[model samples]
Target: MQFDRKDKNNAVLLDLYTQLLYPRMVEEKMLILLRQGRIGKWFSGIGQEAIAIGSTLAMEENEYILPMHRNLGVFTARNIPLKRLMAQWQGKLNGFTKGRDRSFHFGTQDYKIIGMISHLGPQMAVADGIALADLISGQEKATLVYTGDGATSEGDFHEAINVAAVWNLPVIFLIENNGYGLSTPTAEQYKCQNLVDRAVGYGIEGVQIDGNNVLEVYDTIAAIAAKIRKDPKPVLVECLTFRMRGHEEASGTKYVPQELMDAWAEKDPVANFEHFLLTENVLNQELIAEIKADFKAGIEYEIEAAFQEEEPIANTIAELEDMYAPFNFKPNALSPDAPSTEVRYLDAITDALKIGMYKHDNLVLMGQDIAEYGGAFKITEGFTTLFGKARVRNTPICESAIVGAALGLSINGYKSVVEMQFADFVTCGFNQIVNNLAKTHYRWGEKADVVIRMPTGAGTGAGPFHSQSNEAWFTKTPGLKIVYPAFPQDAKGLLLAAIDDPNPVLFFEHKYLYRSLTGQVPQGEYQLEIGKANVLKEGRQLCIITYGLGVHWALAYMDEHPELSINLVDLRSLQPWDKNAVSNAVKQTGRVLILHEDTLSTGFGAELAAWIGEHCFSDLDAPVMRCASSDTAIPMNKVLEEDFLAKSRLAATIEKLLAY
Candidate 1:
């Protein structure tokens, strides 16, 4: 392709010329700093500046951009202030994340740019979520997601793209296929001639373009953006380019051949664009010199000035703060004269969902077999028919994608209550939960108001895969609230409370208690206090501190032995469990027994016991004791399953605590 300054939109092309120059200049500056030991490390997109700048130009101010480390160029083109970027590189308090993170992994929500995680491809699902938010709201905006050729190999790439295609979401997936994913070449990554060809499997429009050509990239993205804005469907655009430098400053380019390097260097996007502009006489070389000089001066000043700023403080107390969003909500109080119905725990959950959906117009439910099939437990039996499939969705058998998409969806003013089919399967989405959902609020003041309904606890002879009490996995996570209900009323009320809370909540509905427990629940909408515990029975001999199915087990033990008066306390919320309630019970009984269905080692019971020992040491008449399942997989046999966490075991533990 040939370029004539008079035939082209010179103004737009000239602007792109300057935008491309910023990243190139920053890359050069960073490489020098890396060598000088001023910066820790650097990941440069030196050769492929055109893809970053050109695609950014095509996006509107309102559209969202999820940028990877290499796409720092996108930030520069969006005018994100070189000073902040420099300060971030230096770990200064003035930087994004307040120097909590050091690189392109930080972004301001106001900028509509989501920072990337070190783990690639998950953000694709997140971006789809952001786009889905707009589609559901009937907004006229598109989402532009950036990924590298290497990320295309990730499952998230397919999971996200498939959802976007099926929903006809307004999103443009821009892949920077720079010939190499780290050190592995394209031939080894996939057999496909081009990355865009793979998009056909997802049933979306796919296009391949010369990533080195600034005008071609800019024009291609501009058209893709326009098409998605109207028809609201996803498009995949693969930019064929190369990385001139190593993967990062540490990864030297010894694996890259000099011959290939020289060939790519000859067609460098920044250099080639400059030559094209100069040859076409686009306002002469003098103006270009001024623009370069101005950018260089500004970059130099920011780098120097940022160094003089205060180093980010390392305060453990402050860091721990803001881990969870404020748990505050005006519960829709149940009417005094409202009717009560004796409902099963499963029906109570469904009732909560129906009521929540009726109350909040933006509530969405997604999980495998949740819509038409009514979930694996039939908890959502008639949800699709009642609330319609759009609100109650059946997603693919991708746990990570479901959670990732829900995280994205929550960012756009919608509340998502996702089901994990089985609680054991939540491990598949652990990365998204721990890294993305748990840290999102702490890293940036963004809340993913998502509720993951986990059918947890072990009792059924469903073996290791189906039976698991994994509540302990998320108890250590900062930004997540965990609710484990033992009865029908608490199940329904706590779920409603979780759905209303503005942070991610892991609602654990004990599968064992789903049908076994039946109690009269309030007819109208009502939410029990989330972080508070409930004392089902009062006693003076011992305090049984437990929750979920453990509460029922404690009650059964009480029925068996009326001789030992025990105070059964349900710590409904694990993360912010009721310390005050536990303290009061311990003070009265002077003997504490912490029990749960999870394994003994590093379980939630351990935390509870530690807390009691720390805060209620003098109040305890004896050492804090706990009875939990052994640190092994839940057994498939009925005899072993009962022995693992049976009422008999808890009864013996209570008797021992009493004697002590």
Candidate 2:
């Protein structure tokens, strides 16, 4: 099997050729499989194989690369087993995501490859997080993330690059300018001369390379990577390439002009690289045939093995169990009998964050103006001085970037708590929260151990923009834990527990209760169970189920009406709300009323009422009712806001239920 090439360059050339040829052969085989219905889909990287092969091979083993769906060569160059990759493509149990995701949608930490989600630009931000983790740990590692000419137009692309540039994190923003984005040509995508030209706006170096030339890609990327490691900074490298095939097998390239296709065909990466190697005598006709034959046989064998592999079976319990990592709620540093101090809900949260920082060194706090300015609510006041800027990081006003970065940090052995200055502002980063962070665990078994602190609820007359009880939006999304605490003790305990949980937990802190609610809180570290509901008052006449500000309103209503005995349940966690406690309370009281600050229609209260009606039907003396804010935006006027909230209607709703 030995080749009679004496030149040292021969070995390097052969390695590059083999790496380049493997993915090409694999893609060709996969395309055939797709036509035969053996595989579901194929995103051919036939012409652009050189870019992936060269750039990936140029990086050090410890460094990370986030590849898009088109970069099949990145996986092969990293030497990931062909069989497992085939299994993944075939949706088999042996795959990286265990058939949960297809193709490059899954990331493998073992190989230092962070996979891309469907939203292409978010991975760029994720790369920033990885590089930030390395920088924080004093490692000279760099991250390389890929995007297309089309994805460059996405807001995340700008946010990611701008943040990376500002922080001087070592990152390579590789744009594969493949001319077309699902049939939309580059002419329609942007007005810029080249994708790399946009890099100047972010204050970063920009370079354009002929992506068809593997040697150019390798040399350019290798040099940039070395320079980045020595002096950390972000660089934008645009690989001028073309997609030789349709976006996917199903999408035909009828819109592509015949002449354009013909022109690009002449610049075939695999054929050109082979011709170069042959001209240099590093490879001959016989050697090329042997290499292609070997790759084809290996790919065929793996494909056959992947076909034999079992499809992932749907097990309800196991699937549910896989949604989150095992959460171990730690015992309190102070015993239950220990002396407690009264503090505002805001101070309790601050204390918990401080304790969390002391406990978990890798815990990072990220938000706008959270460091020096002490945040909008001043929850992290003096945090930068106390914990240093590294841990208590003040991020730019880029929610999507920070949220995606938090997921990236979670990927690399760090727990992050992202604070939305206001809960309403979370809509800006909704995709990162619901799609990326929430689905990461279920899709790839990569737990996003991030806590998003949402200062939620209305009553401050902050208007529609600042005041919103938006917990109901995320309760519908699976794989996310939503924790809304009503009191100071619960706020501290639930937040600490959320920080410890190995999943993305949305911790809702009511802006109204932050300073108003004062209660006896344990002085030291303590974490309450996340999904458990606490009963504030025990009664049998009627039951009220609520969380956050609703708990306060219900408590006050019960205090005003002493004759109406009520069982008040504070559902601390919405996603895994205490169903058993709610059902038991309903059965005990024989009447149940669901309440929340969110709008009435399709709110979390509606869900609770439906569950109570379905499960506790026989025990109910009256129909399960709900009291929530009117279906309208929170108004700025204090009187209108009061009227809009469920608090004004709570007594009437409760009395009506009791009377029934």
Candidate 3:
């Protein structure tokens, strides 16, 4: 193809032939900022500008794109305000996140870019979902997702690509093959020689380009994207790029070979491009000089603006900000307005999901057996038929993928609801939930709207692994919402409320309650605000705090011991706990007891008791006591298992509290 020197875009391209020196210089300046205490850590895209700009040129501006830490080229090319990027580097509020979202993992709604996932390699599914959503909506936008070659090792990369290819979604997966991952070279890290080749397994188009050649990268991607628009299928574009900077701040080039660095730097992208353009007679000296001056001035303005920008204060998240969109407050969920409608517990669970899905379009449901099988307990019976397969999806048997997909999907305009076939299997996604979902919100103020439902709380004789309640693990996560429904009405209402809430929620349903539990439900759709504990029976002698199926056992024990006075309180939610209600009951009763089906020692019950003792010690007549399962993994024997749970021993504990 002949070069069009007269074209403005091509004229600018001539300047960019080795023009990334400006971007490279900016990367060095960022390092200076780190030493001076002006900024925190950084991931530089110094030598990899061609990959970013080249791959980006072929992308539709409206298409969804997920970026990684060292993706300044993607952000810069996409016009995601350069000054704001500087602000983000400085950990200031004016950046895209406004000090709320994580510095690296964020995007502007207006920009149409998505993600910077906490986990290294899960955003692929999010891009796929975006493409899937666009396809369904009849909008012809593609989803262009970028990841390091190192990320290909993640299971999500496989799961997402396989699904995307099979479904024929318009998504372009860009692999920035930057030779090394931190310290490990690709040759040593991956079993395969080329990443693009792996796309064959998924039946997707795979292409490789010289990542150093800017023009080649651009033209090739543009052609591929055009084909994607026509064919509307998945394609893998591998850009063989190289990293010149250290992985993070203060890291050394000690692991990187000096000879290779000197060699690659000699063929520096900026220098190579400039030489290429000059040799082609596409650019003259004066135009190139002017572009450099202009670029320098523009970046200086960004740096200055970033330093002048302000950071957010504490009151913003606690008081000033809207929970969801710009104007409306995310539904201020309501507890059942009155007594239960006298509905079955399973029906309440169904009603809860329905309410949330009805009130919020972003709320979506997905799980195995949920779509065609209607759930193992039929809790989601008819849901797929009502919501359609798009919203209520039946996923393959991959729990890690299921939860990980939910976490990624939440990055877009989605509030994902995921179901664990059994609560015990939640172990499969423990890392995503604990390391990513749990900390993402508090650490970055990023919104991870997810509802994970697990049938928990024992008594079904389904054996230890399937029957154990694991509320403590969720409660340990700082930013998650943990809600356990005790009654039919509360179950439905709280679950709906959790769906509408901005944080991730773990709604642990007691297996025994599926058919056995019953209560009056609200007439219309309703919500139960998270964190409020409901006192089922009021008494001055003692306080019993329990949730899930334990609430029933607590009530039964109260009825049996007519001579003993105890207030049975059902803690519907764990995180953002209702400290006021707990304190009031503790003060009134004099003696308090905390109870839950999760094993003792550092469990939710223990935390509750510890908090009560710490905060309400002066008002209490006796030291707070906790009734929980023995501190051991649930065993297989049914009778011994019954003996292991606090519910089985609640009567004696309540009597002990009553005696106090």
Q: What is every candidate's alpha-carbon RMSD to the true fold?
A: 1.9, 2.5, 3.5
Tens digits of lDDT, candidate 2, 1-660: 112223338789889889988888888888888888877788888799989998999899889999999998999889999999998888889999888888789998889898999988899999999989988888988899999999998999999999999999999999999999999999999998988888889889999999988888988899899999989999999999999999997898999999999999998888887877777788898888888888888888988988899988989998888887767676655676877999999999999999999999999999999999899989999998888998898899999999999998999889999999999999989999999999888888888999999999899999999999999899999899999999999999989889989899999999989888899998888888888999888999988999999998988887888887889999988988898999889888998898999999999988888888788799988998999999999999999999999998988888798788
Which pairs, if any, clash in model 1? none
Query: TM-score order of candidates, best first?
Result: 2, 1, 3
Error of 2 at 114 (Å): 1.3
Of the candidates numbered 1 and 2, which has the greater TM-score value? 2
Any idea what lDDT model 3 has?
A: 0.75
- lDDT, candidate 2, at 228: 95
Predicted model with the maximum lDDT: 2
- C-alpha lDDT of residue 82 in model 1: 83
| Candidate 1 lDDT over residue span 1-660, tens digit each | 354343467787788788888888878988888889888888888888888888888899878899888887789878888888788878788887777776888767778889888898889889888888898888888899988889999888888899888888888898998878889998999888888998888888999998888888888888888888888999999988888888987887899889999998888887788888887677477897899899889889988888898997789888887676766677667776779999999999999999999999899999999988999999889888888887898888888888988988887778899999999999888988998988888876788889999998788899889888999889998888899988898888999999888889999998888888899999878998888899989999989999988888888778878887889899899977898999999999999999888989999999999988999999989899999998788889999888876454786787788778
**Alpha-carbon deviation at 174 in model 1, angstroms:** 1.8
Q: Name the candidate, 1 or 3, with the larger TM-score value.
A: 1
lDDT of 1 at 251: 88
| TM per candidate | 0.96, 0.98, 0.90
Give the candidate order by descending lDDT.
Answer: 2, 1, 3
